[model samples]
Target: METLKLKKLSFSARLFTRAVAALSVMIFMAACGNKGGDSAPPNTLLGITNCATCATSIPSATAIDVFSAKNATGLAQFANMQLIVSATMFTPGASSAYNLYTGPVAVQGQFIAGTTLVDPAATYGYGNSCTIPAGTYVMQSSTVGQMSLGMLQLPELISTTGVVIRMRVDQGMLYKDATTQQTRMYGSVYITSVNGVPCSSSFSDVFN
Candidate 1:
């Protein structure tokens, strides 16, 4: 008889799970606050919460590089698939490869959506030699709204309109504002496109 092996979770995935656990604790604490006080629910991973208004400024590094060292191997998976991440409700910038969103995004969309197609090799100007494969990959997420395998529609995703994009669920992290204690999700995804084109892809964003 052949034995089946179970894959161990990646380091990033472990961290993501820990972050979610922390968020759950925060939510419970927020709910138990004094009734007379203005107790707003702590932000969940599902969506934004006054992100634009948050006092913390966006980091200078790309979203993928913001939290920790950039995961080159993880990044390659997204590129091989010709997918890019987008900032929530905002258009990706055209000057760079991967065009990962770095700003706060509003509700709706993948917290970001890719609006164009750039060469997969140009991501971060690393001269990636990976080729874009056929088929679709949905943006990877563990949130309730993102759990479904259905095709997500975002008119802004010109190249990836009909295609599905995949992102590593472990690459994402939940960000909590030190001042406001509000939490948000920031993670990586694949991207390919610049200035808009016909090829399909999806982009991931790192929200602060």
Candidate 2:
């Protein structure tokens, strides 16, 4: 009789252990499902540029698309997320290769210029600007003049019909000089659509 009782107890314990294990697995699966569902929210498609590989942070006024995203809970998640800048220009054709930045001009702000002070032993030039147009532009490099080693493309300027224009600088890349061997500097420009479209006017006037 004692033997039978011991056998029954052992069986019950084994069954209880199996049940606990099953329950644990179910809980784990539920947690995993919740985690998988929680992905970074989708962001609006913005222009991509290579960041200036320098010490200074690109100013915010040069940013293009500036917006925030929220989760289903209505909580703000990513704010002012900028586009990733590419190190090299986007080559569509063989002759389409262009420098990312040219000598800067006063598009919205002051007329900043591109610099040629690069680190020796590097092959590319550095010092880019953080200004771009709203429309898409083809990247090109200028073979003439002082500004000769960055990306260049003219964008179609539009009128900002009473909307707040925001800028966000994200990334940059710097080239090194072949002789001096110093790291060059680069910056990005992200232009985004405002209330209607971005114009050459001030942000306040854009909303007016």
* Full-model lDDT for every candidate: 0.29, 0.24
Q: Estimate each model's TM-score.
A: 0.27, 0.16
Q: Per-residue CA lDDT of candidate 2, range 41-149, in tens? A: 2254322222232112222213221222222222112232322222232222221112223333111111111221111112122222212222222221111111223
Runs in model 2 lying further than 4 Å from the true structure:
1-94, 105-159, 172-208
Clashes of 2: 42
Candidate 1 matches the true fold with a TM-score of 0.27
